[model samples]
Structures are given as C-alpha cells and as structure tokens.
Target chain A: MQWSHNMRFFQSYAMKKQLWIIVVIIIAAILPTIIGAFWINVAVEILIMGLFAVSFNMIFGYMGQLSFGHAAFYGVGAYTVGLLMAKLSIPFSLSLIAAMLSAGAFALIIGYFCIRLTGIYFAILTLSFGQLIYYIVFEWYSFTGGDNGLQGIAAPHLLSSVTAYYYFTLVIVIAALIVMWYISRSPFGYTMRAIRDNANRTRFLGINVKRYMLINFVIAGAFAGLAGGLWGPFNQSISPDLLNWTESGIPVFMTVIGGSASFLGPMVGSIIYTFLNAFVTGFTQYWPLIIGIVIMLIILFSPGGIQGLIDKWYKHSDSSDENIEL
Target chain B: METGGRNSGSKSEREEITGESMDFSLIFSQFLSGLSRGAMLFLIASGLSLIFGVMNILNFAHAALWLVGAYLAYTFWNLLQPYGFSLWVSIPLAAVALSAIGWAIERVLIRRIYNRTLSEQLVFTFAMILVIDNLIKIIWGVQDKAIVRPSIVASPVFIFGAPLDSYFIFVIFTGAVVAIGLWWFLSKTKYGHIIKAAVFSREMVSALGIPVPKIYTWVFVLGIFLAGLAGGVQAPIGSITLGMDNAVIIQAFIVVVIGGFGSLLGTLVGSIIVGEIYAFSILFWPDGAMILIFVVAAIMLIIRPWGLFGTPMRT
Candidate 1:
C-alpha cells in the first residue's frame, strides 16, 4: 500500500514535469516567429550550445569527473561533418551520424585512460589529449585546413534559411534532450550517482566503476559531437578553434552558470550565456571581461548557480505553505 | 679526425630527412638552447608547482599573470630607457609590483574559494584568466610590446663553437639563482618547513596555531613574484603580445604535471626534459614538436600521475 502511494506521487510529479516541458516546447516553436532574424540566430546557437552543455553535465554533474578536454570530441564531431560534406559530398544527415560515431570513437580511446585517475589528474590528462588533437588538426594543413579552417560548408536547401535552421535545431535538440532525460532517469544514471557519492561502496556492491565511468564519458562525448555536428553547417564553416581548450571552457561556464546539480541546469546556463553573448557583443568588445565579472559574482555569492537559487526560493515558499496549513 | 669522419659518414643519412648535418657543433648548440629553454620553463613552473602543492588550487590564470609581469616590465623599462641599467632595474621592480598584485588577488578572490570544490576553484581561476587577459588588452592595447636589450647582453655568446643569445645566459643564470633560492627557502627556512607541513595537512598546520591563511597569501605572492621575474626576463627574448599566455600556460601545466605537482626538484627535471624534447624535436620533426610534447605529457599522466619526484597524496 505504501509503495503504491509512493508510485502515485511519483507519477503526478512526472506528469507535472512533462507538462512543463510541453509548455516549453510550445514557446520554443513560436520563438522564431515572434523574435527577429538576429535573435533567431542567437536562439539556434543557444539550442546547440545548450545541447553541448547538457552532454557535458552527464560526466560532470552525474559521473562527478571534470573532463577538461571535452571540446576535442565536439571538434571531432564538427570536423567529421565538415570533411564529409565538403570533401565526399555526403548528405547532411549521414555526416552528422559520422560525426557522432567519430566523436564517440575518440572518446573511447581518450576516456579509457582518463577514467584511471580521478580529480585533477583526470582534468589534466583530458586537457593534454585535447591539445594533442588540436595540434594534429592545426598542423594537417592539407587535410584539416590547418589554421586557415574549412570554409564553404553550406547547409541543405531546407535548412539554408535562419528560420529553417532554427526549427531543425529545435527538433533535434528536443529529441536529444528527451533521450538524455530518459538516460538520467534510468537505473544506469542512478548507478552513476552511486559511484559519484561513494565509489568505494559502489565497487563493494560489485559494480565495475571504471567501465561505467568510461561509458558515461563516451556518451557525453558523442552528444557533444552531435552538438558539434550541428555547428559547422549552421555557421557555414568550422575551424581548429572548435577543439581548443578555450572552447572546452564554454560548456564549463554554461554548466556553472546554470547549476550542475539539476539535470537541465546546463541548458538553462546555455540560454543565459548564449543570449547574453549575442546581446553584449552587439555593443562592446569587452565581452570576456563582462562575463568574467558575472561568473566571479556568481561563484562568490551563489555557487549553486541560477537553478540552485530558484530551488531555494521554491523550497522557501513550500515551507511557508506548510506553516499556513499547520 | 676519426670522430669528424664518422660524423660526416652519418651526416648523409640524417641530412635526407632533417636537411641539416648532425655534427658536434650542432648538437652542442641544440643542447645549450635546450638548457636555456629548460631554465625559462623552470622559472615559470616552479612557482606554479609551489602554489598548487601548498594551496591545492591549480591556478589557470598563472600564465596570464606571468604575461602581466612581462607587460609591467616593459612599462618600467620604457620609463627608464635613458639609463643603461634600465633593463636590469625593471625586472626586479616588475616582480615586486606583481607580488603586491598577487597579495591583493589572494586576499580578495582566492581566499574565499579555499574550501570550494575542485571544479569551482578551477573555473574561478579560468574566469580570472579571461578578465586578466582583457584587462591587459585594455591597458596595453592590442599592439605587441618589444624591449630593447642592453649592450651587456645584446649580442650572441659563443661557447665551444656554439652561439647563444647573451640574454639567454642571463635567463639561465636567473633560473638557477631562483631555483637555488627556492630550494634553500623550502628546505632550510622556518616558513618553508611550515609551507611543506601545510601541503601535507592544512588542518594540522592551523591546529598548531600557524596562520595558514597568511602562509597561503605569502606563498601566492611569492609564486606571482617568480612569474613576474620570469615575465621580465621573457620580455626581451621575444615581443610580448596578446594571446601569448594561452600557449605558455598549457606548456607550464605540462611541465608541472611531468615533474609531479608540488615537487620542486621534479619541476626542474621535468622542465629540462620538455625543453630538450622541444629543442631537439625541431631538428628531426619540426611540425611534430608540440604534438610530441603533448604525447609525452599524456604518457606521463597515464603511467605516473604523481610524477617523478612527487609522492601520491589524495586521489
């Protein structure tokens, strides 16, 4: 009887979450129509970057390992698509798949070694590996275009317009988010949380800790690649900068800004970050300084980020309601 | 004559790939170049290692600060350009100025994050890099700044048929003095022992009534001072420009990792290894130098995460 009651409670909570998402989707679908072309471009960027940040949070928030080189996978994904379409004349859809696959493959190799150590060592190893890839891409002028970057990557006729690209990104991003949401709610996700909370105990329970972490890392990398795949055609080009360490910091900034504890925190972070980037750069070139000051304030005053702040407010209101009822 | 003949015989084999004859003079020159390169790296990495070793904060903004030091040195030298001793005077002055700035940063920003999660600390410092870099651009403008070297160290010096820039000798000399000075401070001085103790267990040091926060501030200041000195030393070697810190910070990180975090001797040794690898690799594989360094760093990280001289502490 108690189990049944708990199940009902969970079901209603899930229903509320689903309803909220539906409302959000409706708003997103209408956003391009209401906003100007410039804002529409910004929205597309927000969606792609949001997806990237969400993928990053899989390893960061769930698995509790900071992969500083995550941008390597993203870069690989972009390069895969860029090369496929530009060189082999592959279809956009097929190139994206290739991007995901290539990014995952790279992740498997890199993550295999990275999962051996935890904390700062993991971060450094990932960074070194990322730099390794960056140099390869940077120096291979004949193949990867070196510092010149790959140009003339046009999207399909259907997604050539900014509005069309925004819709396409919205659909793909929604699907990716749904898939990730299910993964986060699955038993595998719980197992990751267990490992994060207490790796020793998780091992004692006869789980393969390293294997699970590696799998998580690969999944995150693949998703980041998916986001990267979207980037090349959207921007009409790709560069070696996509895989640079500075690019890796983008998702990190988003995750920290949004709140790493919540599943959708990074997405929220991407929205605020990308939107502000678009808005701020319109006026001044000191975007980095401004963002730096904002991040500093956020870290100093509210380490939990925007989601954490909202959750606190919600809980505070809930307590007041209980007080009134009593 | 026999050695020369043997070298000539092998030169044809090497020349096909490298396009340069492998001779005693070439090898000796490369070795000296590597030594000077290693010394510069040592100057930068030692402070970075010390800060991370004691404070448990891996500062991402370190190279940016180092860049700031270089810019400050330029400004100082520019002011004193009329004097012959300008370059010599500016280097120490820049380091002292940087120490003051370091102390302010520690008290204001770093002190708050002492107990935060590792990611938070890393992100904070990363953000600092962005802010600091931009500030550098605003203050110094986007143009590259070059310092003219004094006559004393203006020309190339020949050692055993190898020509080296005279300023590099000064850089090497400064590196050695700083390395020795740091070793003495860490090993022989009372505060150095306190710092060593703090690295092992901060709580215990604090429990013993030693001001851990004060130690942290001073250590940070000292580290920044070294960075400043390095920057001042580096300014004349090449033109100081925007985005120079980006490449250097990563290289320094590699140096610290290869040496083992918090190990002074390891940093020195690792710097030399990297320096030699970088200098020599340019001969055989010019394009692959950076790639080779990264590969070596990755291998070191995989095989011995604790590094050569560092003992494994917390996971």
Candidate 2:
C-alpha cells in the first residue's frame, strides 16, 4: 500500500513536469508575436546562452567539476562557424557541424590534460589552456583577423528575419536540450552522478572514472560549441573576447543563478540574466555591479538558487497535507 | 664587455631578427628585466599564496584589489605631489588603505561563507571582483592615471652596461625586503606559527584557543596589503589603467601555481622562472611569450598538481 502511494505521487510529479514543459514551449512559440523586435533578439540570446549554461552544468552539476575555460570551446565553435561561413561560403548547417567537430577535437586535447586533476587545479588548468587559445586567436592576425574580429557574418536568407532566426534557434536549442535531457536520465548519466558523489567508490564499482569524465567534458564542449556556432550568424560578428575567461564566467553565473541541481535551472537563469542584462543596460552602465550583488546574494542566502527555492516551497506544500507514514 | 654590442643598435636588432650572434650585454639586460618582472610578480603573488595557503580560499579578487591599490597610490601621490617623498609615502598609505578594505570585506562578506562549498566560495570572490572593479570605474572614471617619478629615481641606471630602469631597482629592493620579511614573520613570529597551524588544521588551532577567524582576517588583510604595495610600486613603471588587473591576476595565479602554495621559497622561485621565461620569450617569440608561460604552467599542473614546493597532503 505504501509503495503504491509513493508510485502515485511520482506519477503525478512526472505528469506535472511534462505539462509544464509543454506550456513553456507553447509560450516560446508565440513569444515573437507578443514581444517587439528588440525582445525577440534578447530571446534568441536567452536560448543560445541557456544552451551554453546547460552544457556547462554537465561539468559543474553532474560531474562535479568547475571548468573555468568552457568559453574556449564556445569561442572555438564561434570562430569555426564565423570562418567557415565568411571565408569559405559554407552553408550555415555545415558550418555549425564543423564548429561542433572542431570544438570537440579541441576539448579532447585540452580535456585530456585537464581531467588528470580535480577541484581548483582543474579550474586553473582549464583557465590557462583557455587563455592559451585566446592568445593564439588574438595574435594570429592573418587568419583570425586578430583583434579586429571577424565581421560580416550574415545568416542565410531563410533566417535573415529576426523572428525566423528566433524560431530556428528555438528548434535547435530544444532539440539539443532534449538530447541532453535523455543523456542525463540514462545509465551513463547515473554513472556520472555516481562519479560525482564518490569517485573512489565508483572506481571500486568497476566504472572508469577518468574516461567517463573526459567523455562528459567533450560532450559539454561540443554543445557549447554548437551554442557558439549559433551566435555568429545571430550576432553577425565574432571576437576573441567570446572565448575569454570573463565569457566563461557567464555560463557559470547562469548555472548558479538558475540552480545547478535542476536540469532546467540554467535556462531559467538565462531568462533572468539575459533579460536583466537587456533591461539594466538600457538605464545604467553599472550592470556588473548589479549582477555582482545579485550573485553574492544568491551564494550567501540561496546557494541552491531560484530552482532550489522553488523546490523547497514545493516540498513544503506537498508534505503538509500528504505526509506518508513509512 | 664589448662596447661594440652597445653602440650598434641596428646590429642587435638584425641579430634579434636573424636569431644569431646575440650579444652578452643584450642577454644581461634581458636577464635584469626578467629579474624586475619577477620581483613585481612576487609582490603580487606572495600575498595570494599566503591567503590561499592559510585560509584555503582562492581569492579571485586578489588582482582586482591590486588594481585598487594602484589607483589608491595614484590618488595619494596626486594629493602629496608637492612633497619630495610623495611617491614613497603614497605607496605605504595605499597599502594601509587596502588593508582596511580587506578587513571590512572579511568581516562582512567572507566571514559569512566560511563553510560554503568551494564553488560557492569561488563565485563569491569572483562577484567581489565585479563589484570592486565597477566601483573603481564609478570613482576613478575611465581615464588612465600615470605617476611621475621623483628625481631620486627618474633616470635609467647603468647595470653592467645595461640601461635598466632606475625605478625597477626600487621595485626589486622592495620585493626582496618583503620576501625576507614575510619569510621571517612566517618562521619567527608567534602569530605566524599560529597561522601556519591554522592552515594545517583550523579546528585544532581553534581548539587551542587561537581565534582562527581573527587569523583569517589578518591574513586576508596582509594579502591585500601586499597587493596594494605592489600596485603603488608599479605606478611609476607605467600608466595606471583600468583592467590592468585582468592580466596581472592571471599571471599571479600562474606564479602561485608554479610556486607551491604556502611555500615562500617556492613562490620566489616560481615568480623568477615565470619572469625570466616571459623576458626571454619576448626577445625571440613575442607572440608566443604568453602562450609559452601558460604551456609551462599547464605542464606543471599535470605533473605536479600540488606544485613544486606544495605538499600532496593539501590536494
């Protein structure tokens, strides 16, 4: 009887989750109609950055490692698409694939060196390697256009309209998120959680901890690159700054703000962060100061972030009337 | 010592281009420049090492604080410009000011997050950087501030026929004095011993009635004080500009990593190696200099994650 009661509770929970997802998607579909062109652009950014932050959470949330150089992969992805589209006149779809492949390749190399250590050492190594890539891109004037950055990256005619681009990004991001969601639910995902919770114990259980970490790292990099690839045609330009340490901090901020424990936390964080960025910059130039204070508050008072807050309230409401006696 | 190497500037340039027939004096000058660079790094990184070593809190705001120090030094120097020893007075004053700020930060913010996760601690400090940097913008504006050197060290000094920047001598002297001073304090003082014990086990030290939080506050202040001093010393070397801390902070992190965390001798050696590497690489491969330093640091991290002088027990 108790088991059945628990099963009913979980079933309702899952149904509610699916219902919420559908509602969000429907809202997203009609968003361009309701909002202005300016907001449409911001929505596009929210999707792209949301995808980036989620991928970063693959390391931070699931794998339990902090990668300060995640932007390197993002930057590489952007540069790949920017160069391919602008220089070779490659189709946008092909360019994005190339971006993912190239970013994955770089991650494979950088991650091989990075996965050897954990904790602060991991963060520092990734940062150094990221800077190495940044310097190369910054200095290689002939190929990368140096500090001038690559300009004139126009989207294809089909995506030329802001609304069309928004829809396109929506489709791609939703597909990516679904794939990541499945991965997070799979046995492989459970293994990652095990490794995160206890690496030594997981090793004793015959799981290859390092190999799993490296694979997760590469997957995260590829998705971040995909997000980066989308950015070039949308923004119409790409700079070395995209791959910088500061840029890497963006996804981290989003992940923290949204709540790392929940899968969709980063997306929610992206909504709040990107919207606030668009709104705040309109009036004041002290956006950094504002964001800094917000992050500090989140860390100090609500370390679990907005999602954590919601989860707490949710459990509170559920347990009040439906307390099960075990 | 051949006078020919000194006279023929074009010849040396040609030699540099061709990568052949390098003069001894040119190498000596590079070495001296490297030494000065190392000294500057030491001034910034030693404090970082100390804070991380004792508190286990990697202060991402260390560089930002250093930048603040530079701006403070400029402000003090500007106010005391009529005085002959204005630069000297301003440097220490800047350091003292930074110490006060550090104390406030420790009491209000850092003290709250002593038990938070590593990522939380990192995020907190990182946020501090953003707050501090923007505050600086609001206060100092965007314009670059340059300090004029006093007549005492205004001109280049001949060091073994190399025209070394005279102010660099002062920088090197200050670095050595601080390093020796830090070494002595850590080894010789009662508070220093308590701080070391806290690093090993904060609970044990607290159990012994040492007030570990007080030590943490002072250590943080001490770290920021060094950063401020480094900034003041750096003021006369070039224009104090916004975002200078961005580059220095990364390099300082590299120095701390290369030097074992918590080891004074290690930080010294690491700073010199980095300083020299940067100096020589700029001579041969200007574009690759920063890249090479990063490569070395990555290699060190891979092989010795704790660093050369750091114990594996910390890891």
Candidate 3:
C-alpha cells in the first residue's frame, strides 16, 4: 500500500511537469501572433542561438572540453543550406539535412585533430580550425560570395511567411533541444562526465575516451548546424563572419554566464544573451565593452552564473531549515 | 585584410618590372622578407611563451595589446611628426604605455582568477580582447592607420646583390637583439633565474621568500612589452586596422604552438618555419596560405601532440 501510494504521487508529478511543458510550448507557438515582427524575429534568433549554445555546452559543460571552433560547424551548416538553396535550388527540408551532414563531416575532421590534446591546446587548435574555415569562406568568392555574403535564401512558399518560419524554427529547435536533453540523461552522458572528471581512470575502465569525445563533438556539430540551417533562412543570408572566432566566443560567454552546471543553464543563458544583445546594441556601440565587464563580473563573482546563485540560495535555505528543526 | 592584396600587388608589380632577373632576386628577397616576418613573430611569441611558462595561462588578448601598441605608436608618431626622430621616439613610448596597461591587467584582473579553472582564464582574456578592441575603436575610430617609416629605414638597401628594405633589416636586427638579450637575462641575471625558477616550481620559490606574484606581474609586463614592440614596429610595414588584433593573434598562436608553448628557443625556430611558409605561400598559393598555417599546426599537433619543442603536459 505504501509503495503504490508513492508510485501514484510520482506519476502525478510527472504528468504535471509534462503539462507545464506543453503549456510553455503552446505559449511559444502563439508568441508570433501576440508580438510584433521585430520581436518575433528576435524570438527566432534566440531559439536558434539557444540551440547553438546548448550544443556547445555538451562539449564544454558535459565533456569538460571547451571547443572554440563551434562556429565553424555552425557556419558550415549555414553555408550548406545557403549554397544548396541558392545554387542547386534544392528544397528547404533537404537542405537542412545536408547542412547537418556537412557540418558533422567537417566536425569529424577537425575533432580528430583537436581531440589529440586537452585544455588550452584543444582550445587553440579548435580556434585555428575555425579561423581556417572563415578564411576559406572569405577567400572562396565564387562559391561563398566572399565578403559580400550569400543572400536571398528562404524556405518554400508554404513556409514563406514570417509567422510560418517562426513556427518552423520553434518546432525544429524544440525537437533538437529534446534530443540533447535525452543525450544528457543517457549512459553516454554519464561516461562523458566520468571522462571529464578523470580520463585516466576512465581509460583504465577500458572506455575509448577520444572516440567518445569525437562522437560528442560530431553530434554537437550536427545540432549547431541545425541551428545554423535555421539561421541562414531567417537571416536571409550567410557570411564568412559567421565562422569567425568572435562568433564562436558567443557560446562560450553564454555558457559561462548561464551556468554550465545544470543541463538547462546554456539555454537560459542563450535567452538572456539574445535579449541583452537586442536591447543593448540599440543603446550604445560599445556593447562589447559592456559584455566584457558583465562576463568578467560573472566569472569572478558568480562562476556558476544566475542558476548557480539560485541553487546556492535553495541549498542554504534547505540546510538552515534542518538546523532549526534540530 | 586588404593588406595581403596590397603587399602582394606591389611585389608582383616589382617582379613585372624586373622581369627576367626577378627569379634570383625574388628568392633572395622572399628569404629576407621571411626572416623579417619571423622576427616580428618571435617578438610577439617570445612574450607569449614566457607568460605560458611562468603562469601557465595563455592570454588570448595578448594580441590586443599588440593592437594597442600599434595605435599608440600611430598617436605618438603623429604628435611628434615635426621631430626628425618621430618613429624612433614613438615606438619605445608605446611599449612603455603598454607595459603599464599590462601591469594593471595582470594585477587587477588576472590576479583575481589565479585559482580558477583554465577555461575561466581563457574566457577572462577573451573578454579582455573584446573590451580592448572596443576601447581601441572608441579612441581610434574604425579607420585603418599606418605610420610612415623613418626616412633612415624607409629606403631599400642593396644587400647580397638584392635590394632589401632597411626597415625590414632593422626588424630582423631588433628581433635578434631581443632574443639574445632575453637569453642573457634568463641565464645571467639573478631576477631572470628567479623567473625561470618560478616556472619550475612557484610554490617552492614563494616558500623561499621570493614574491612569486611580483615575478608574475613583471613577466606579464615584459610579455606585453614585446607584443607592443612588435606592433609598433609593424605599424610602418603594415596597416594598423581595427581587426589586426584577430589577424595577428592567430599567427602568434601558431608560432607558440610550433615553438612549444613555454620554450623561447622553440618559438624562434617555429617563427622562422611559419614565416618562411607564409612567404613562399604568398609566392605560390596566396588564397590558401592562411589555411595552410592551420593545416600545418594540425599535422604537427597530431604527430607531436606536445608540439615540436613543447614538453609533455601531465594533464
């Protein structure tokens, strides 16, 4: 009787959580109708960049490796769609898959070299690879449009409206986020955290650390590419600047600001950063300076970020209550 | 970025004018150019190598200091334009200013995060880049600036039957002098030995009553000084633009990686290798030269994971 009661309570709790998630999704779906075009566009950007940040956190937060070349995969995904739609006149849905594939393939190659080292060396190598991609995109004028960038990219007529595109982006981004959430809870995620904590001990256990990391790298790239695929159509263009290390730095900054300790930390960070960027850039051109100061403060004062602060408060309250009870 | 094209265009035009005799001169001149390029890289990477050896932190914004130096040099040069020794007077001034800035950054920002993770250090410096870059833009505006080479070094001089720019030769000389001076300082001076000792075992050095943090500040300042010197010198040879921070820093990283992060001697050799590769690539494959650096670095990394001159790290 006691076991059955506990099971009923757990089932109800799970249902409530699912219901909340559904309600959130419904709100997100209707957001375009409620908001203006500018805000809806901002919303689309937030979702895409949010996915990018989450994918980046997989390597940084979960795998304990900060891969700085993330934007390279993101750019590759964007360019794949941009090129396919603009040059080959392919369907938008097919272009998205191709974007994921191309980005994943690129990640596999770069990750092979990058995974050989750890810590700062890995960061440098990934950054170098990213810059190489940017250089290619900038110099290869015939294919990439060089400095001018590729433009006029869009989805099919049915999804041509801004409202329709927002919904499309929302659905794809949510699906990707769900898959990422699943991966984080899976045994592979446990092994990742183990490797992060102690690679040698994990190696002693007969796990191929590098191979697992490479797999993680490839999956992260595929998801970043998905974000990029959405980005190309939404922005209606793609540029070499998308592959620049500055762009790569965005995810890093977001992850740190959002708190890398929790699974949803990067997603929360993405929302904050996107909104901050949208709002801040309107006030001053020295946004980078402001951003730098913000990041430095976060690193110094709240290394785990806003989510970390909340957790600390919750824990402190919980412990204090127990002490009072005692 | 147009710096690449302008430099290449002038080289090709000079080749067209020289015509048949261009081959021998081209090889010799390219070699000279390569050496000068390597020397500049050495100037930048030597400081980076020192900081990494002693602090074990790679300051990604080290390149931003170089940009700052270039801009300061531009300012000083313009202010002292009436003076006959404008370039001579301005370069050292820029280097000094940069050292002060570096000192503050090390004390105020870097000191706060000494106990944090490597990723935090990287993010800190990366943020520093954004801050510095914007500060530069705010002060200097978005336009690219260039200094006129001092009249003494502006003209080309005939050396080995090839006309080489005096400024280029001077850069090579400056690089060699700095390298030798650094070696002497490390090997001969008491403080230099302390710095080296600090790199080996900071806790032990600190336990022995040496102020380790002070040494770190001095080492960081010296690194920034070298970066400033490289930038000030290059201001005349190349355009000092808003994005030069990003452009040169990656090359500096390639130099450090090839030289082994903490090894000065390795930095010198790596700089030469990269410089020569860049020079030859300009002659043969201009469009792909930048990509080639990453490719070579990747290959070197895979073959010798610690780098050519780097010792294996335990982590």
Measured by TM-score, the strongest candidate is 2
Measured with C-alpha atoms, the lDDT of residue B275 in candidate 2 is 96
Residue A287 lDDT (model 2): 99
TM-score of chain A of 1: 0.92
lDDT of 2: 0.89
CA lDDT of each prediction against the hidden true structure: 0.90, 0.89, 0.86
Query: Where in model 3 is the C-alpha error above 4 Å?
Result: A1-26, A317-326, B1-21, B158-163
Q: Compared with the true structure, what per-residue lDDT tens digits does model 2 show for residues B1-315?
A: 343354345655644533443366578778888999999999999999999988888899999999999999999999999999899999999999989999999999988988888888888899899999999999999999999998878876644455678788798899999999998998899988888887678889999988788889999999989998998888889998888888888999999899888878889999999999999999899988888999999999999988888887665
lDDT of 1 by residue, A88-184 (tens): 9999999998998999999999999999999999999999999999999999999999988899999999899999999999989989888887888
Ranked by TM-score, the better of candidates 1 and 3 is 1
**TM-scores vs. true structure, each candidate:** 0.93, 0.94, 0.92
Clash pairs, candidate 1, are none
Winner by TM-score between candidate 3 and candidate 2: 2
> What DockQ does every candidate get?
0.76, 0.75, 0.62
Worst 10 residues of 2 chain A by lDDT: A317-326
Q: Which prediction has more favorable TM-score, 1 or 2?
A: 2
TM-score of chain B of each: 0.92, 0.92, 0.91
Interface RMSD of 1: 0.6
Q: How many backbone clashes does every candidate have? A: 0, 0, 0
Span of ten consecutive residues with least summed lDDT in model 2 chain B? B13-22
Q: Report the lDDT tens digits of candidate 3 across residue range A144-192.
A: 9998999999778988888898899898998898898888778898888
